[model samples]
Target: MLTPEFSITQDDDFIFICIKIAAIRFSAANLEMLVDENLFIFHLSPYYLRLRFTQHLVDDERSNAEFKSQDETIRIRIPKATKGEFFDDLDLPTKLLARKGDILGADAVKAPSKSNAGPLIQEIDTPGENGNLEQAGEDFNWEISQTPMPPSDATRLLTSKYGFDDNYSSVIGVSIANGNDINELDDPEKSNAEDRVQERLRKENLKFDPEYYVSEYMTAKYGNEDDIQINGIKSLLKFTPPLVKKFLKWYKQADDKEAVMSVEFTEVEQQQMQKNLPKKTYLVDDVKKLYITMLSLLFAYMYEQVENEGVHNTESAWTIGKLAPQLSFLDQQVITESAASELSVIKAIVLTGIRRSLSYPLHRNFDLSIKVWNYVYYTLRGGKRLVIQALLDLHEVFRFHDVYYVYNTVLISDLCAWFIIAGNENIIRSLAIELKKELDQVTKKDIDFDCVCGIDESSGEVSWENMNIEEMEILSEQEYLQQSGRPA
Candidate 1:
């Protein structure tokens, strides 16, 4: 049976659901709906939809169903089990469709406290210094950092056998293999220099359709982005999988949190990942944390791809390969080891993660996303720690099922499949739950007016120190002379 297009809305006392089936008419028969506790089942010959909700619904004297022949839509209204009880995640349609599953067990427990006071950032310990570092924070600290380790000989043999050791450099036109300099890779936007002109023109000439933007991108029926975010987080608290719950419980009982984040996948898990994931030798210092970073990056990229390009298809796969450089900033060759907590790496994650999480799966307004980014930047003033906290939380969620191979068998596969496959969009809803939680919490801070805005600190005025050179129309003679004095 086909799942028809649907929309959900709610008031204080009643929950409203409208399902649109193109074939339905006034004469249609066998239309049935069964409300069993929180699960609602609907069947109409060729159409079927089963939704598992967070709150209970009852069909009684106040319940009603109507069929509109003019629009061929079925509208159902059910009273809330308890008056004034709010239903969360009504905006997350795909998540509502999740099948009934086992409840989380007692093994699930709370994560470690993030309220400790101190520097929010840490780096690898240097000689003559204790492992302690200090910064300007009351007691909070950014996420922990770990450098990527070199590939072992056994791993190198596997990559060579799999013919993926080149590390996808051909697509991005840069090599970051072991021992190569990332600085030599150039800007991510200019990865493929041969097609730079065409890509720039494509970006510059794109047109915006107001109607599509409003109806599809903005999702007016889902209310606003803030509502969507809050609802998503509330759902995470209610609907996380059994494995995730158990993992949380196990983490709470662990003695060494850092060891949990650094665990390696088993050999069997490696074989499973080799089938689908890229087989190249990965340079990872902390395996779990690195995957967590990729998880955030890929989740963000998938949402943006869906909103901008419409849906997953053949083109989407190519898009992933083509834009791989911009997504992770790693190249084909690698000379130096890199850490997840490096300012540059963390900065890229923040820029991409903030923009995508705040804007996609609903509102796609460019201006609004930027405003949200600015609000987040100055609020917590701890983007690094905020992101790390989110990742750590997500890590616990992941460890429940595949503690040995969560990155290979679960996180990356689930996300990559959702990005390129059609029916797997449901996973996106659950991911949004974790992401929205972090975004909403940090955005609650009072705005910081002292935040820098590209002003020349010495002159106390707005400055063009980093203005776009291409858009520099008016220039002083001295500046022009200085430019002319430089060699091409």
Candidate 2:
């Protein structure tokens, strides 16, 4: 065997390495030789080598023991090239021969005849391919496949492998593997399970009823629809059915409450009411409360008309003017006398009815609305003294400015107006004075009165140009004050 040797040296100034391979031999008589005694040189630069060996193959008897034995030698050389360009400068033959010899030296040489480079060959025999396979198979024990396990057994295997107990279904078993607890796995016995299950469920941060989670998700994402139905039986199994039943029951009860007062009022009545009353200027809560109170009173009035009077006058829709009088009478009868204890109860029921009407899903007739408003106004106004005294008694309850303002303004205004119309100037003046004092305190802070004065300079219509005596007086005073130089 002829051993291959290579020598390499670098010139520091040139940044190139000189590589040389020597003693390459070939039997010219027996082996085909492409080239002989060739000096392959490469020019290398700082960045790139002149020669690069992309692929190589070597045929050495020692490297391929199954091939015919032969002595072979290969040599390669490179001179005066930078390290980066050293390989680039080398010729192809030199690059190929050098890399091939390097590979042969690294690997144990085997005979060419025994090399695995030729045709495909099988190393193992199967019973179908060789009759001796049966003899070989006889050494190994084989038996009939065991009968398939029952679903229960399969479930047990899955649970055991995934660390789940009997309470956990297969889906929950998978979830447990993903860091969820078996207790979190939806189970039918969530409520009936031992306290330990509940505790475990709490620890696992699992909902007792999965449907609740789904419903919450649906409401948040899709909003409330008329009817919602869940799909998929397996998904359904993740929730306790009885818990769902309870939720459905509650939903139905709520639906019933909403249905009770959802009466629609006529458009004509709405138009008429809108024409009669000033445009509504109230806060959202106040508007809602007003609408609800009207609806409830309308409902009560309708009931009274139908049951007591045996009348079916839907045309006589409630109006603010109409209901106010009735409400005032009811208030006088209920609140002014020694039966004051019943006043709180009446107020509570009225407030509750108002709330229910507001939350009710449908609209009510405008006439009915007007009637209810009238009733509420009259009731408060008729029992003004009693109502004010009651407010004083429960001052804490009436502390909110919004509630107090509406109650005093609308309710008390109705009473004063009615009294004034009835030619009771004394009562009107007394109420007016009291209201004025309250108004003064309320308006103590500087206010933007432009809106109230209806002055629109932007329209180019100077209505104030023809000043009245009062206005001219004020203007003259202002001019005088400015000229007085007293810092007025």
Candidate 3:
């Protein structure tokens, strides 16, 4: 009772079977195979061999077998009976069912299994039973070594859960064969929003310059209105007073003492606040440069409250981009570590949260890091270069604010993109390896996230994990600014 080692892999249309064998001399008579819906058999010389598939290939008629010249590997490629589905009764064991662990070769190394499912299958073959090739070969008989479990679990898993009818491969916006458009069918609200945003972005020739954006938005929305007329005359920000308060308070608490000074006042702020925070005030002047930066922070605040009346998320985009630099380390770690397969889910979840905390049983909505970096780089001036420092500063201020969940939301995949933008390839690679190591044990759930290393332990009564302010690795802003090539 000898069973040859084999590995089975599958993609959308094809099932790939690899049979490893010792070198067999090439001859039409010596090497032959029989492939069909129920079984796959391979023969080498007088010693006959055969294998039964768990699922029959749909196009077994088109199945191709080739013996690779190197590695003595016999390869059989069979297209799944259906486009994306293999046969439900095709005959694979439960060992191949579990997603965990790897299946090994034929050396009785028993394809790595988490648990035994009954006994091993040892099948013997007699020539000609499976029609080995001499004018349909000769009479051959095959044996089954280990009988797999009744098809209940694997069949349910294969047919019901594991995408037999699931349109997981369908493109989001495009129409499929039934004329079903996911954008139209799945979530119209989100789809419409994306279309509107994408269209508006293209239409407006929108620039990130806060002062100049009015020719693009405000006047367009409210023509000749008093606030608009007043702001047009003075060039005051529509949301400055509120954001300024948050900014000044954040400045006092954050480690970056001189960041507030980076606010270079233009003619606008000079006219608007000449008394308290005048242009060229004793401490700092002309708040022109950091207006976009400050605007970004304010937008995060707006994003937090965007669900309220008359608050548009798209309006906050350019402004929110400016503060992308202020993302926290915890956020960065999560963004980089999140699974690639989980991206769309993360994006959807992230969009849903919108500067808010997610509830438990977290459904992988980890899109913040990706989106933040994307918009920041796309919309903010020199954002790709300055963001890492901003993220560092953000960690300081937010950790001080003690808003763990909101902080986590900011460091989404966009942050990982930022690392790439910063040319931190080696560092990003290290982080990915680190993330894979972390995932090896526990999954990346939204929990007590930390900066330095490893997942932060869960703090009581909080979203993700909350750590004390003292436990954080807050980089002093003064030091980073001095060394970071930031403008004085």
Better of 1 and 3 by TM-score: 1
Question: How many steric overlaps are in each model, in order?
Answer: 22, 52, 47
Which of 2 and 3 is ahead in TM-score? 3
Query: Cα RMSDs of all predictions?
Result: 19.4, 44.2, 30.4
For candidate 1, report its TM-score.
0.37
TM-score attained by model 2 = 0.16
Mind giving the per-residue lDDT tens digits that candidate 1 earns over 1-488? Answer: 87766778889899898888796444445888888889899888688888778789987899888987778898999999999998864644434655443111111222233453222212211112111112121122224343233545455333221012222323322223322221223343234322322332233122222233333322323347776564342222233222233334544565542222222233333223223432222332332233233444443433333334323442332233223332323322211123233433333343344332332234443334333333222212222222222233232232343221223232344433222211211122222222333434343121111122366669888632222211221233335447659532
- Residue-pair clashes, model 2: 52
Q: What are the models' TM-scores?
A: 0.37, 0.16, 0.19
Name the runs in model 3 displaced over 4 angstroms: 46-49, 59-61, 86-488
Candidate 3, residues 1-488, lDDT tens digits: the string is: 23344556677888777766664565655767766774566676633445444456554467787877788777888776667764431222222221211112112112223242211101111111111111110111111012223555554333221000111222222222433211112322122212332332222122122223223233433346775564342232222322333343544465533121232223332222212110110111111112222323433443332212224233222223222322210111112122323532223223222222211111112232223222222212222223333333333333233223233232322222222122221222222222222222332232222222234357443233233222221223334346767753
What is the model-wide C-alpha lDDT for candidate 3?
Answer: 0.31
Q: Candidate 2's residue-wise lDDT over 1-488, tens digit each? A: 22122222223222122232233323323422221122223322211112223222122231211111242222222232223333221221122333333323322222223232221111101101212222222322221111223556544443321111121223322333443211222332222212322333232222122223333333333443433233222222232222123323443455332111111223332222222222221112112122223323333433233222323232222221122221211121112223234433234234323222222212222222223333333223222232222222222121233222222223332222221112121221222222222222321111111111235678865331222222333444566558766454
Ten residues in sequence with the least summed lDDT for candidate 2: 119-128
Best by TM-score: 1
